[model samples]
Target: MSLDVTSPPVLSDVEELVPSRYAVRIGEIDVLVISDGVLPLPTKMLGHNVDQRARAAWLNDMFLPPDAFDWALNTVVVRNGRQTILIDTGLGMDPALNLPRAGQLVKRLKAAGIDLGSVTDVVLTHMHMDHVGGLIVDGVKEQLRPDLKIHVAVAEVKFWESPDFSRVDMPPGFPDALRAAAKHFRKEYESQLQLFDEEYEVVPGVIVTRTGGHTPGHSVVRVASGKDRLMFAGDAVFAVGFEHPEWHNGFEHDPEEAVRVRVRLLRELAETGALLAATHMPFPSVGHVAIEGDVFRWVPVFWDY
Candidate 1:
């Protein structure tokens, strides 16, 4: 059940694409892992503070391209009794973004046999484009499930609303585009949007924890049913974190604080042996963290049939 960091799972030959949706159980609750698609991130954008040569060596060790890496997009649907909540919405199909292969969440959800109408709540981990883009369909910004109540962290909204947020230095028009997208979603669903702070139970069995660092109000959702615990760590740590927990990523707003959060939470997760699901790990990104010596390693869970 545990694999070392140096040796990861490998696929041989040209295997047919696996189902975009996968089902797993956390105690009595049913969790459906839905894929949106993959994002090709330039390697230079990662490990901002790490030496380029060292980073390249690490990437090569994983049998990955040293120039760019593929980040899998995954979202989780938790169903328990009458409550059906989504952890995060994936990137929506948008041709303008030029990500031709990255926005198939709608199709993936359907393949998972999830009735969009049955979803009563959407708990957002953050407001980044990839995480919130799926809220709008057909260029219309609204709740995916017409009657669903949307939940977001209170600090997340406050952070995005500040003028400073818009002034933050980013590539050319990225800041403007980010603010625009966030503004549209907030305005479109202002009526149904619910904001929360502190560790609170959002649903009967799901608890949302404020673990900000990547963004001002980034969070993690924990689902507890029976005696099992599954943590949905939204952008808290990527695959590279296993080998370099202190590596600062370019996407983070507060680099130092991000490292603190990643190291602390990853250590705790490893000690407690809890199941983890993240947005940017490989598809159906479910795994467990392991502490080897003084660093952390990722032990991806074998897909349950």
Candidate 2:
């Protein structure tokens, strides 16, 4: 029989042709990077402070479109044999926001053999809708254990009570949508909220530390075991952030302070040579940070098939 080279390869469920989850061992701990799907956003959102020409140049250099780009939505699962920890939930289907592609976290997690009930701890980077929206999806709360602990910075909950959006430069309806989503999440999960002051250890090797700046309660998770270290850097670092740590992302509530946080985190990563992953980096976002002159570089890890 002749081979059909042009035909697409057969998949188990036919749900997706491309891979949606990647697994790696961080020494004794097991780490998984799951795709929540992509969000198409304007290039200007990357850095509104920089001139359009500069943004255009960078996008071109990367062989991307000039007008917009798809921001990768990655959520991570960490298992230390004792607890199943979820770091940041991805965006759920929000009809009001018209983002249909996002909110794939629930289904994708199931495909990866993880059940909502099995997730004992949730370490939130902040109270942003994309980071917590998946937990508030219809019927999601009912499936989760009643005692599920959601770890978030104490300042995150208070900020949404009377959020100040004066400094952010989001799209026309984003500020309103963000405020409502955060409010709804808090109301739905109030009983499960595990508020932390600055730093908290989730498990034997996984610890979360507040970085502030992106949001007052923005945080990052560090996992270390047997000389292996990886940072789940939430929104503190982005695709462009590695090269232009000074540029202000439009979503940042305090852009100037966000810049400082990015610089500090990047510097630390370069010095430590730890693996780096962020919410909006490309799928399987694990990588290492390197310093090049005055700027930093992202060296993505090679995928092992």
Best by TM-score: 2
Question: 109-192 in candidate 2: lDDT tens per residue?
Answer: 888889999999999999888999898899899989888999999988888899988887788788887888899998898988
Q: Give all candidates' CA lDDT scores.
A: 0.80, 0.91
Steric clash pairs (candidate 2): 91-103
Which portions of model 1 show Cα errors greater than 4 Å? 1-16, 139-146, 163-173
Pairs with steric clashes in candidate 1: none
TM-scores for the candidates: 0.89, 0.96
For residue 281, model 2's alpha carbon misses the true position, in angstroms, by 0.7
Residue 77 of candidate 2: its Cα lDDT? 98
lDDT of 1 by residue, 1-305 (tens): 76558764575442226777778788889988888889877786568787899889888899999887888888999999788998888877555557777877766666666767778888888888778778766643432566678888898988888624421223344456566768877877889888888676877779888888888888999888888888899899898888898887767888788889899889889988888888998877888999989888899888788
